[model samples]
Target: MTAHEERPNEPILLRRDEGGIATLTLNRPQQFNSLSMAMLEALIGAIDDIARDESVRAVVIAGEGKAFCAGHDLKEMRSSHALAFHQQLFRLCGRFMMKLTEIPQPVIARVHSIATAAGCQLVSMCDLAVASENARFAVSGINVGLFCATPSVGLSRNVGRKEAFEMLVTGDFIDAREAQRRGLVNRVVPPDELDAEVERLCASILAKSPLAIRMGKQMFYKQLEMGLDAAYQLASETMACNMMCEDAGEGIDAFVAKRKPEFRGR
Candidate 1:
């Protein structure tokens, strides 16, 4: 890697690699990986780098130690020094979550423990998520006098409105299986199988054409806000554009030749 492209090295987070998968571990276990300004900055920088780096195909966001994330740093929030800093701090956290959705590479949240408040927002913002059966999730900001207003943006889009509303208003934790049933997570496996299961899922996504994956992910979110007829029109236009890509041509040619296609992500 280039000098300016060095991997992130910070106490708030840890970075590890395997093939094209970049695993980012939240390191603030003492605080349950709660969002600190520094940690949020590191995460945004890491994701921005991944977007520009051709070598990274997929990403996994997980936490070290017990909890996935407990949301914002409540200790920091309660400080007299934090009164004037709240708006900027929350904006940074929101940007970090939005970056996960905007990045071209798919992000998988590996939830092996509790994820609450903004933590739940992080899970919902990812392209896909796999949780350990022992894991639990909640939007507990309501109990604290905050409404989880920002988290609801992503949570509402992922789960049914009623379910999101219940989680937001009641501030109750739900089991991993219940989260899956409510469409908040894609899969739930045993705690011991969490890492292996995330690898298995990422491996499958990495096998597809990278260019198509990028375009499809971008379009998927874009069309979600459009009217059905307009969305179909946009989709058709996107497909036509995708068909013209070099990877698509090679994919079709390789199919006819009955051989695997070598994609360069052109």
Candidate 2:
């Protein structure tokens, strides 16, 4: 797959192909795709749209230019009215992040360059992430006197507490390989191979029953916060429910018949 040629007039570009994959590209590369108020609103809107869209089975979040996102727009934060804007801005940002968990569609982050501060938080929010080998990641807000409080929620959950703390405190960059070791990303490939790798991964997921994939993703996150016993209990309950779905029945029948299953996603 070639890099998508973006068209003009596409703010928070949304494109869906025949394969049920939806790609959302951040369109503000002029500022390193910084998270300005407008961009934040656009992103939230796009995610909301995808959540409600049945045609979109898998979603990929990518940036328009070199950087995935540079985090919050520093220029906006430096305005004279910064103090007055924090509450509203944080509320929107927090809500946008939380929405990622609520959505049933599997979301992937296609990271090509640096994902810093909130950008890094965005990566952590994704169900899966594939990065270019040259990509650099950091929670660099602390160095600027702003703690990456929100990012820590996702980062700490993925990586060890000590490792998360080290990145947060030092605001140092970590290469893609270390990011994979730390569980920040699922895989790393060359920049030229990023699109193909992401497409390959998404296609694998798309081949599964949509309902199964949706419920599985939901249960995965829910069980993450539960005790082992509680998690097992939840998993058992979810599996029972999944087995009752039409797709599950078809899958079982197909296996017995030695034929490929055609799932209707019921």
Candidate 3:
């Protein structure tokens, strides 16, 4: 976004696969891994691809360099100051955030250094986040005279309104420990241990029945927007359907037989 343009030969997002875990690392380290238009497009494409790839049971979003994402490409916005461009840019970003939840497999964020503005949204958008103890977080666009309205949507959902508002309005940074205390992140570990902790969480989910995880993820997000009675109705139906799946049947049978459940992903 700055004078330094994204080189045609350089990747904005890098993908690595292992044991069904997809690790997507934002690749523009020189820009603090900011989400430039190209990076956003790459991420959106990757998300869509992962949605269709049943083999990828879990996804980890991480950054390649000193810091996690610093939010949108500020330089790009300055270069292209039209309302039409702004609208499309924001729509695309918001859609990608929503897509993170819509995907079947759980998304885990490996956070470090600073995650601000849309970067903060990235952490909040994740199903779970494991932050390095020294990591910092903030929805800091307000400091630059821009309100983090979009980031606040995800931030408010993760933390309390008062806490979220304090960060948004003040542009204050929270350490990983504080983030965990406020529910912004699930765990905080020594910086060197971040990867191990993320993998531990991934393995925990990997051991579960994929069918149960997929259906539960759907029911979980849907219930959040429902009235109490409606939520209960939907959850009950989902549970019934889940129990009818072969994985559930096998799980119960395995329990009765005193053995680990062998999930067929049915």
Candidate 4:
């Protein structure tokens, strides 16, 4: 059966598309939008759908209610003590995180408030993040005697090892501006301006050639794990291939003619 068919009540995830941008809002406000099994499945389904949709140029992940996301549903996690169940749950969460990077469209985290534990990891996994001034972040699993092992992967990639480790070990919260300075998020704006800032980023990305964005995003992430020489080799090949596209030709011609280039996502 379809994922939605299994849900007999209110949806845990809400999705809306507008002007080439798809906004996926985590919908468990009363629970602080924690990542339950149902929520993860819903997100995975929505992301798979977005990946196949050419009309979507960008994606925004947002949370409803006061906090952005407080991480996994602790109550649910405690309900099951089986080692196999915990393993499967984490594996599913990891898969959902990796899917963010694999998708062609740029994923932006719209952090309006606190994003703790795995929720903080979710922000780190996003391609870009715009957080409100009031937003706070922490990998707080350590506070309760559980290390955020899975979250450390994405957190370490985004910030310095020392900073990520410090947060992981101490479970201390950092303000939005500090998170930006440490590279956890790209921009921090007033809470009232959070949506506007996110839209600004989406607009900038949407204005670019879709083909180039897709090609570059894939190459960008892959090259990060390669040696300098191999990275350069891959980047050169990507640029060469991008240049061969019709949008590149049109863009060059338009530049020469001093006019706006019309890109058809070629």
Candidate 5:
């Protein structure tokens, strides 16, 4: 049973926070946690809220049920059947994907099962991904006669052009280890150890200075779009500004004093 069929009235997005880590679970387990229009809206609202909250140092995007996400809700798409509607849907989803990288806090995808179509796009867009051994990924929209054009944007950015094209055209699903090898995911662990691995990754990010991380993340994405000299110029300015932050001074001094630097997030 799909998430919509199994639990039609449940919340689409669920949020939980502890120890500076914010987890946003796609809660339509029966429907394979697919991204319907409502689901997209829910995610956008949750992400916007998280962006304004300083307490959220990191975010984990996980899905509940047999699959991480099955991509767009096909049944919903069939019901629309309008060119304008299709365009708007893709546009909204594209904005959501861009926002994932634009956010200050790092976003990590917690992939537990099959991530197909836009589901795979979600994994590619995250700053980092940790998949369970049981996880599988593919942008398989081509199988149904519609090319995964939007998903290709993130997939190509994460992996190689030829490889991304192969998946797009063939609709082949790659296992978690292959996803890792292709640079789509950071690590792949046993299914039973997924939470532990996510926690480990989350803990490492939390240990960094928040201001530095916030600044660094902005520079990281923006610099990728610049030329070598321009990238270095921007990086140099970013570093100079970062050096003047209170946390930078404390971090350098603590290193010399042989003590842990306390960051007040200034």
Candidate 6:
């Protein structure tokens, strides 16, 4: 049974925090955690809250139940045959995907099962992704006669243009290992090891200086959109500013003195 079928009153999105990681679980299990309008709104709100929270050093987006996510709620879309509604829905989804990159903390996708169409787009938009060996990915909207235009935006950015276009047109699923090889995910482990792997990735990010992570994340995405010379100029300026931070100085001193650095997040 889907999460909604089991508990109709439960929140469609659930947030839990432990250590420095904030995990957002998509809660529509019966619907395969499809991105309905309400789900999109809840995610945007949670992401906005996390963006301002200095304590949240990292985020993991996961889905509850059988699938990570199955893309848009087709039932909901069919419920409203209005063009304006469809336009609004895609616009909201695009905004949420963009926010994942804009946030200071790194967002990692925890894909336990299938992630298709907009669901695949979610994985692509995240800073990193760790999937189970049993996981599958696809942008399969073409199967239903609709092109996954918005999903293609993130898909193209993550993988080669030809590879992404092939998926768009074929509506074929790629296994976890293949997805990793194609640059869609960072790691693929056994199903039983999924949680452990995600936590391990999170631990690595949490060990870094928070200020450096924040600054580096912002600079990272910004530089990706710039020309080579402009990108270097921005990177140089960022490095100079980062070097002036107290954490940077302490890190260098500790490295030379053979001691661990205690970063105050300045």
lDDT score, candidate 1: 0.89
- Give lDDT per model, in order: 0.89, 0.87, 0.93, 0.94, 0.92, 0.95
What tens digits encode model 1's per-residue C-alpha lDDT throughout 43-117? 998888889877889999999889999998888788746555988988998999989988999999999999999
Looking at model 2, the pairs that clash are: none
Worst 10 residues of 3 by lDDT: 1-10
Error of 4 at 221 (Å): 0.8
Candidate 5: pairs in clash: 2-30, 2-31, 3-30, 3-31
Per-model TM-score versus the true fold: 0.93, 0.93, 0.97, 0.97, 0.96, 0.97
> What local lDDT does model 1 show for residue 211?
98
| Model 3 C-alpha lDDT per residue in residues 1-266, reported as the tens digit of each score | 11224576777788889999999999899899998777788888999999999999999999989998899989998988799999999999999999999999999999978999999999999999999998999999999999999999999999999999999999999999999999999999999898999999999999999999999999999999999999999999999999999999999999999999999999
List runs of model 2 lying over 4 Å from the truth. 1-18, 80-84
Badly placed stretches (over 4 Å) of model 4 are 1-8
The CA-based lDDT of model 6 is what? 0.95
- Candidate 5, residues 1-266, lDDT tens digits: the string is 11223356766788999999999999887778888877887788888889999999999999988899999999889988799999889988998999899899999999999999999999999999999999999999999999999999999999999999999999999999999999999999999999999999999999989999999999999999999999999999999999999999999999999999998777
Report how far off residue 217 is in candidate 5 (Å): 0.4
What TM-score does prediction 3 earn? 0.97
Candidate 2 lDDT over 151-192, as tens digits, reads 899899889999999999999999999999999999999999
Q: How many backbone clashes does candidate 3 have?
A: 0
Question: Which scores higher on lDDT, 1 or 5?
Answer: 5
Candidate 5 vs candidate 6: which has greater lDDT?
A: 6
In model 1, which regions exceed 4 Å deviation? 1-10, 81-84
lDDT of 4 by residue, 122-187 (tens): 999999999999999999999999999999999999999999999999999999999999999999
